[model samples]
Target: MNVHTAARIVPLHENDPRSQDPVLEELVDFVGYRPNALLTMARKPGVVPALLKLLGVTLRGDGLLTEPLRFLVAAEAARGARCRYTTTHLVHAAHHLGIGWDKLAALPSYLDDPRYTGQERKALAIATAGGTLPVREPAQAIGQARQVFTEEEVVEIVSCVAMVGWFNRWNGLMGSVLEPVPSEALAHVPWLKNLEV
Candidate 1:
């Protein structure tokens, strides 16, 4: 189950001063540890701070979507990309927010699952569109999402998906290693079916 790639890049170890940069500390605070993705992104100048800022704005939008629901949307996007890397983080954040492992394991059936509301379903659908791409009907996805969400709210949902899209592509290609806190905390990997890249 070693999912790493042959051309894997090493993340900055905690002892590396670059890993201790103030902006990088924000990621430490957010994830409760220095994330491997952030540590790797830190190798480039200014990417960490700017990306973290984008994360804050996207995840902490104008109070339209609840924080837990935001994590829910992210889970769908992670499934779309078949990224165990990002989904592991979502499970970590979800647990911190009091969302349970049972709920995470049930995500594949969200469309008919009683756990999600119509609005949440729309947002999840839109998120998957972005993550999986060339989504047969782009306009249809946006239209469906707009039905249950305001223009601003739709933008918020899109922001969540787009933000994760970065990680989906970067981590998938870089073969970024998953941190134990989230990766191991996740009880099961049912969101995507044999689709982790």
Candidate 2:
């Protein structure tokens, strides 16, 4: 039998009851294959399904944050969490949104980059501060966000960050293999590389 490529436990095969979820199918259609992360998370019974529901709402449902901004927020949060797995997936997502490699490459220096506009810079700052593990001094970044965005938009920014926070921790701790779709799409994003422990 082939070994589990990611996760502490084995992932479910296509015929597994838990793997038959519609949400999982949608994910497969979007990415061109079942992501191993979701497949492994499916092994737990409810996690992948529940997460997909939340993902549809937070990442897809109407929100004060623009669609493009949401991607940036998630990517920035993934970057802050240092979860290369999640960041790699976000790279694929960004491409679908018409956000380019160079634009994403600017993420490491987003705060001062000319590529990012004033509002994007504001959102990125909040993502960095809110996404910090120890939850550093977020007052300044959030306070700045409030000045430019509505309270709802600020919540959207923070919520998007919080949502990806799960993936950041889950994929990081599980050592989730970078799925083929994202692995091929990785380009040459240097900072997304996880350091060898």
Candidate 3:
């Protein structure tokens, strides 16, 4: 699907007095900057905090998935959803975590890449299945994934994909503009050329 050319809703600019919701500060601290999507969602007083809190649980809480693995899951889902904004953010985050550039650049072809562990490939496949529209995750894929990942780890993997699902839809619908940080960070990768927007 093509990215929307215009936002369905108007976004709040950082300098706008109306954008001064206190929760935006929390997001800034979380991400090192106020992403355009979060600032836009800050239009609703409650959403920013609630989303961040959920993100904390999904990303930072005790779980079988490592932070790097979680980032891969998120990126896979974002790419499947064709969401450049979300894809760029997660891929940029992966780079910061010291995951190899070639591994990241090879994400679309994970099945053949030796760099990705079997567990990582399973999670990526699940993420790919989950990210498609009409939301069809194959039973075989989930079952196979379960063999390698614990039931809790499967939940964590699905949770990571599910989280990006929200951002992918939100940013896709919002036509959210990309910020410079992730935009710049994603520049060196070839497969991520879609993120150049």
Choose the strongest candidate by TM-score. 2
lDDT of each: 0.76, 0.77, 0.79
Compose the digit string of candidate 3's lDDT tens values, residues 84-108.
8888888888877678778898999
Q: How do all models score by TM-score?
A: 0.89, 0.90, 0.87
1-197 per-residue lDDT for model 1 (tens digits): 34554427888778887766776676577668778887888788788888878877877434688877888788778878788787778767876777777767777887898877788788888877777876646677899988878999888888888888888888888877777677665546454335574
List model 2 lDDT by residue over 1-197, tens digit each.
12235566555677878788998788777667777678778778788889999887777657777677798889888888777778778767876677877888778898788989889998888888867678777898999888899998888888888999888877766777766777655565666664210
Any runs in candidate 2 off by more than 4 Å, and if so which?
Answer: 1-6, 194-197
Can you list the residue pairs that collide in candidate 3?
A: none
Better of 1 and 2 by lDDT: 2
Cand. 3 TM to true fold:
0.87
Better of 2 and 3 by lDDT: 3
lDDT of 2: 0.77
